[model samples]
Every structure is written in C-alpha cells, then in structure tokens.
Target: MTGSTTRLFAARLAGTSVFDPQGDQVGRVRDVVGMIRARGPVRVIGLVVEVPGRRRVFVPMTRVTSIDTGQVITTGLVNMRRFEQRGTETLLLAELLDRTVELADGSGPATIEDLGLDAVRSRDWQLTRLFVRRGTAPRGLAGRLRRRGDTLTIDVDAVVGGVLGLASPDADQGATNLLAAFEELKPTDLAEVIHELTPKRRREVAAALDDERLADVLEELPEDDQIEILSALEGGRAAHVLEEMQPDDAADLISELPAEQAERLMALMDPEEAEPVRRLLAYDDYTAGGLMTTDPVVLAPDATVAEALAHVRRSELNVPLATAVYVCRPPLETPTGRYLGTAHLQRLLREPPQTALGQLLDNDIDPLAPDETLQAVTRQLAAYNLVSLPVVDEDGHLLGAVTADDVLDHLLPEDWRDADEDDDLEGTSGKEAAGA
Candidate 1:
C-alpha cells in the first residue's frame, strides 16, 4: 500500500516521528549528517532532529535504536541545541536530496529523488541505498538537486553517485558542469561547497581544477580535510597539488599521514619539490622547524636588490602573507643554503633596486631556531610585527620560513576555516531555520 518501504527515502524520512524506547515522540527527522571518507563510501554520522520549541539536536547513528515504518527510535539522550554544521558535515537534505548523480555499477545517471536510509541489526543508522528518478533531470542543476521524483529504489552497491548539480532557484548547472562554476568561486567559498560534498564529488572537482587553484582551495581547508581530499586523489595528481602548496602547508599535511603512506606520496613528486618537504618533515609539528616553509623567496647575499626582487617575481612560490626575502650565502638551492639575514619588502622599496642586498640585510632581526616551540614562534612574529620569519639551525643556516598565515592557522579556533561561511550567510534571508 505504501509502495514498498524496504528503502526509506530521505524525502519520506523528513517529518517522520522520532521516538524513545518507551515510544515517546521526541521530535521529527530534520536532516541527515554524514562524514565523507577519503576512500570507500560516505558514512552516515548522525541525524539532525527538531524538538519542541524549535530546537535542533544531533543524534549519532550509534545512539539510534531503530528506523522503520516512518519512525525513528533513539536512545533518548539528546543534546538540545541548533545543529551547527561543521566543515566536515554534509546535510543530506540540504546538500544531496534530489541532486543528479551517476548511478554506480553502470546504471547511467539519475536524479537523486531521495536518499534511502536504514538501521542495522546493531541499531546504527546508515545509508543503506538510494532512491532516484530514472529520467532526464533538468539541465544545469547547480545548487538544487531535484524538483520532483519518479521513484526507483537501488541497492547500496548500485548507488555510487556524484553531484551532477542542484536544481535550485539560484542556479541551473549540471553535475558534470559544476566544476567550471565552482572554479569562479573564491577559494574559501569553494572550500565550503567542497566541505558539503562527498569524496567522489570533491575529487571530481579537484581533478577539474588546475594544480595552483586546487592548491589554493586545499590551503584553505583544515588539516584533516586537507589530508582527506589529498588522499582521495591519485598519487601523481596529489603530488602535483602538493607541489603547488607552500612547503610548510604540504609538510603539515604529509606529517599527519603514516610514514609509509607519506613516503609513497612524496615519491610521486618532483625531486626538487620533494626535497623541501622531506626536510620539513624532520621537524616536530609544534616546533618552528615543522611550521616553516622552504618556499620562501631566497637570494644570494651578494645579489643586488634588483636580483632579489627578480627572484621573488620569477619564482612561482605561493607563500601566504609573504612580504620578505631571505638572504642566504653560497648555495642557493634545495635543502637550503647558509642563512645570512632577512630583508623585508619595505626594505626593498626604500633602497635602490641596484643596492646590494647584503648591505640591506637585517641580520639584527633574530632568526627562529628550528626547535623553537610554537609559542616562541608566535611571540617572535607578534613582537617583530613581521609577515614572515625565517627558521634556521644552530649554524644559522636557513631551513625554511613561516608566514603570518601559518601562525594564524595554529592560533585560530578549530572551526575558524568555516566560521566565515556562517558570517557570509548572516545577512542573507533564508526560510530554512538554523538546523531545519
């Protein structure tokens, strides 16, 4: 009579009753939250439910006792607060419902009519399968997934799909066409969208972007997310993205991975690019050695201001918040040379271009020891009011440099990466309640 409920579509799950063990109605299913794993299928992490007084709460899949017959039963314990979507969370209703996606196992593409969810014997909720309409979806479905449905159920194994695009009132771009539109987005803004997509869709977009652009987006992501996205990409492609990243950022991501895994990724990179990261990996994550990037502009101490400026211009190094060039002695190659002193951009502007940089060097500016603690590094950056600080060994040889942005990444709140997303949406009017 109900058109077979073996696969419970999210559309139907929406507004369904959620009850406690005693059969007490707790709330209604508001949204489904999931974590996009680096490999394998995306996993259902929890559920967003709306209780009395219009409050949203997170109920982990593990806490869910059962889901069947248009009813969700939970363990009763619930945190009463509006659900704040983290950078890693994807709201099924908001991000995936009705989106066009390619069906797994060669079933062609289909509009994600609705997502089918089920509870296991252990009472953990998960995406058991998906429900899609097998028909020509509207072209250019950018932000919205679907407008209507035809009702076809597919098993979990047969449902691997990526975002074709959302069919929303705002934009009409298809899933395959999504990358170009996303390319035009600011890195932070694109980071938000990538945050809301599953790994498959994320990888699709990642592949579409050039190494430099993808590197920019990856830089804007959190360490965990940065690793996840990189992990999903092919080794060569991942290496290229890493090549484009600032040495410190790349090292930061690589350091989080297992040694063997890290080695494998590094192997695929260009030798010159790999050299700096390999050196960076030798430092403790909380130390200046670990925080510094080898991509800082470097010039021979004997070089003139013109040469120093030229070096900065010619090198495609993407150092963040960088405004200085390190003057080193002799070998101006990979794995570093003897550090002489630092020279800021302001110094270059004040001095004539032909002025020999060695004369203009600020050797009095204290250089950071590789083993210096993060606190010490922060203090130094703050005290000097410098955009970048050099890291050196006991011999005063330059190993790398840490930029102001790198310091902020460590000092800011855990959610700072996506906090601005909420800020951007603040003034815009939307009917959907905070978690609804």
Candidate 2:
C-alpha cells in the first residue's frame, strides 16, 4: 500500500466475480491459477471457477479481462465443452498452488504468488523472483534432472495451462538469466539486498516494487538506511513511503535532514504522517525533546497492569521501542506535551495484573531539557543506555524523549571532509595580496 511494487502484490483480485464479454456472470475466482514462463509475453493462469450445483470448472487465464477488488472480469463465458479433461498424468492444481518456480534463462515468469521486481541500473524491471511454499520439492524425474535432457525442456505455456489451467501469448524475450537462481526471497532478505545498493540503486529498486512490498522492505531496513532511501526518492513517492513507515521512525528521519529539505518533505507527505514529524521538528534536535517519539505507549497512573498490556497490544505498531510505559493522567498527550514517570514494558508484562502504573513508577527517572547539545545528549544517553530519554521544559512540562537511534546519528559525521589547501602568497606584497 506504500510502495509501487508492493501495491502490485497487495492488489491481487482473487475471489472477484468473473464476467463474460456480454457482461454475463461466469464464476468467482478461487485463486490465482498459475503463470506461464518462457512465453513471449507473460500471462496469468486462471483456475477453479465455482459453477451451478456447487461444481467448479478450471478456466484458461486468457479468458480474463480485468481484475478488481471484488470481481474479475472475463472476455466471455469459457465454454467448458471446449476443455477436455487431460489424463491424471496432468499436474494437479494443489501441486502448483502457491508453489515457487525458478525462471529459466531468457524467459520471464509471472508470479503465481506475488512477484517482486527490482530495477537494475535504472532502466527496466528486473524480476526478483517468486515466493513459493517451503519444503515441497518438484515432483517426478524432472526434480532430479539437471541442466541437460528433454526432461528439463518443459513447454512453458503447456505446463502453465496443464498445471493451473491458463494460457498465455508467446513472449519476445526469454526469462531473465539472473533470476533463475533465486526461487524465493523473504522480506528481510530483500531488505538486505536493498541495503547493499547505493542510494541511486536503492531508489531504482524501491520504484520498481509495489507500495506494500516497499513498505515491508522499508520496515525491515535499519533506521539510517530508511532515511537514506527516503531522501533519495522523488517527493511524492517518498511521501507515500513515509506515510507507511512507523511514525516514530519517520519522525526521527525527518528531524535529521536540513530544515528546508525536511519541511519540503513533510509538506509532500500525508497529513497523518506529516503531523508527527512536525511535532518532532518543533523540538531541539540534540535534546530529548527533539528525539523522543510522540507515540510512546502510556497508561493512566491508576490503570492496572492488565489494562496497560491491552493498551500496548493496540499500540504495538506505533510504539515499537516501548522500553517503558509512561504513567500519565487520562488522555494521552503528544510526546511534546506533559507526562509522568515511566514503567518498563517488560516489567509490566511480568508484573501482577492488579499493579497500578503509579505504584510501579521509577521515581529516580531523569528528564532532559531542550537546547542541550549533541555532545551532552549522547553522553547522557550512553551513560544511561536508555531506550528513550524523556525531555522536559524548565517547568517540568514534558516535550518528547530523545531516542537512542537519533542520538547516535547526531554523534556521527554527516558529510565527507575536504582536502585542506594553502595559498602560496607568502612572497607577495600586502597590496598585491589584497588585490588577488
């Protein structure tokens, strides 16, 4: 939903009602049947159409017209009479359902499951390959066959149709040679690959992936990596990705960039995303006020530990680094506002349900003031090894907390050094030197 490539996978239209060219109802899609590889143009295979009497028929993918949220539109009613049942030797639908396949060199494979695409050198789509179910090996002698022999020579279109009951037009180019080795990759694996790329390369890869996939990959990246990638994206796309990022992480990133750049990025982002960053930006960067996330999990001072746990479950996505739950008055404030002392999430989880946050609060907790420099902030953060250091004004009014990650960024150098150069004007007169 956040990145372009992810949107493709998340956009699957299965179970939608299929319609014919005349707009007559055909059947609902049971699943994505399969896809044809080695075909000139890649095509989707359709399968398992529910019919009258509770019967289901397998249909060729060629009959499909369009896929939408609730229904799949088809060109026409596939005359079931046209399809003859191949012998039992035919591959069963269950065998290929959600199965992963390696694309042969020079042939493209459409994903039966969602296919991830990566961009190489900023030109065209590079298929990252399919996500197949684990543990099941391909059946028959074909499983044992190596790169040689007729057994390895599968008719791509026929195999697709026979396996998933779909047909595809021939393709001009063959499947990508590099994709043949990767059967499937976990989201974390993909994130690591993205991490290895240069900033430009990362942008290319991110652009190729659908929104939801991009979001997953983004979530997996380290906070710093997320900042670099988002900074590289075009404004609109970057904004979309930021919208999907955890608010706390997103805020941290925006807080690091130059003020003008940060402001521009926030303006382009969706309001829900921009607001948190705006709140964060309002605080001084080196202080806890600037670094603390607004979305910390909090509970009323009087609430029982059981109620606190419930709040945590509901806010997990927003408050991942919830080292300690802050005990505050009713009505949670933005991190830039008031709060009380903190209680650890781990301790709360282990504590008795009847325990109140007020009883468990650590009275010795230290708070930070705004306008503190990076040098001082890092020292405190390092000394305490605190996951989150709360910030407050002179009046003891809470602002936000400085997160460990943000503090680390401030400690690191953001730019490369320039070679020092000396001018050779030692022998020149004062007037000459001034003129030069």
- Estimate, for each residue in 85-170, the C-alpha lDDT of model 1 and write its tens digit: 89766776656653555566675766655666654436444665666776545542222344444568776556453321221212
lDDT of 2 by residue, 206-243 (tens): 65555555676786676667777777667887778777
The C-alpha RMSD in Å for every predicted model, in order, reads 13.4, 22.9
**lDDT of model 1 at residue 368?**
87
Candidate 1 Cα outliers beyond 4 Å, as residue runs: 1-176, 313-321, 419-436
lDDT of model 1 at residue 233?
Answer: 76
lDDT of model 2 at residue 414?
52
Alpha-carbon lDDT, every model: 0.68, 0.52
Candidate 2, residue 103: how far the Cα is off, in Å: 14
Clash tally, candidates in order: 17, 34
Q: Candidate 1 overall Cα lDDT vs. reference?
A: 0.68
